[model samples]
Target: SGSTQCDKLTSEKTELTVTPKELTLTTENITATAGTTTTLTATFNDDTLNTGKVVFKVNGKTVKDENGKVIYAKVVNGQVSVEYTLPESMKAGNYTITAVYTSPNSEKLTAEATLTVAKASNN
Candidate 1:
């Protein structure tokens, strides 16, 4: 039996390179009253690729949406700011908020912020 033979071919591939920029995260308030709206901002210098894809989590849960969905805020000028009202039932304690930014090349950076929830006074 005669069979057609194929030649093996090999080519060199180049790895694209990019410079990483420092990503910073901050919030308008380190403390908030129960059921009050607060804001958190994540900034990336010259990070046009992953700025819009930033995801924020509060106490291990995503922040945003009326139904408490995982989508919140939007990217503008290499930054995404999220405004959310604290849960009324939230206990008076320290809470954690985290923001993660992942690049197109799969490189990721994460930053965290703390929020102190004050108990509502029964005045």
Candidate 2:
């Protein structure tokens, strides 16, 4: 049998930092029907990271509000959200909603969500 030697380990304070470069989007319900409204939220490493604009898109096209106006989400505090109304004429199909967060330097970070549209009600 051999005796083992004991060694002391030292501890040091460590700080970890991360730079956010990715943007993500999420919704409570990904599936929606035509003529219905849904909410989408975009998130990033920092809310203040976006200093320019957060453009929202749908089906590779820009989304509009109930007033038929284009909508853009601005990061307040750390996140941005928007409400979009699906066109009553929208056909039943798979659609993609995207959020493009633009930085002050023109670098764009994009996030997207999916929407499965169903046929409108007969009533």
Candidate 3:
């Protein structure tokens, strides 16, 4: 009598995990003369859970509300950063800068800060 042999097969599956979180923005208080141009910057952190594009705005203007709105807004190493200059002719006052990030899944996050403009000294 001859012996019989048997074999068994098995399959395995793996799933990726991802979490949604808000982006972060940070900057120093802006201080500039009335007639001098000043650069304002905002940094974005993906929080290790969310990754996507971000939008920036100043005083509710649309000029700073898009990816290409500002020349310095470019993504590098999974981070989004933007640098923009304030016009020399802007009036002396306090202004607020706001940034919003929208994830691939339609999740939105916002951050804001204030900028103060000072009058030039005549001395």
Q: lDDT tens string, model 3, 4-122?
A: 57556577887979885545566446777665555555555543433556556668763352354443344344455654556667678888776665667776666677777787667
Q: What C-alpha lDDT does candidate 1 achieve relative to the native structure?
A: 0.72
Model 1 poorest ten-residue lDDT run: 20-29
Q: How many angstroms is residue 62 displaced in model 1 relative to the true structure, after the best TM-score fit?
A: 1.4
Report, for every candidate in turn, its global Cα lDDT versus the true structure.
Answer: 0.72, 0.73, 0.60
Report how far residue 91 has shifted in candidate 1, in Å: 0.8
Cα error, candidate 2, residue 121 (Å): 4.4
Candidate 2, poorest ten consecutive residues by summed lDDT: 20-29
Q: What value does the lDDT take at residue 67 in candidate 3?
A: 54
Error of 3 at 15 (Å): 8.4
Higher-ranked by TM-score: 1 or 3: 1
Ranking by lDDT: 2, 1, 3
Which pairs of residues have clashing backbones in candidate 1? none
Give the lDDT of residue 114 in candidate 3: 75
How do the residues 17-96 of candidate 2 rate in per-residue lDDT, one tens digit apiece? 99856554443337788888877777666546546667788878887766777787777766778887788888998888
By TM-score: ranked, best first: 1, 2, 3
- TM-score for each model: 0.67, 0.67, 0.58
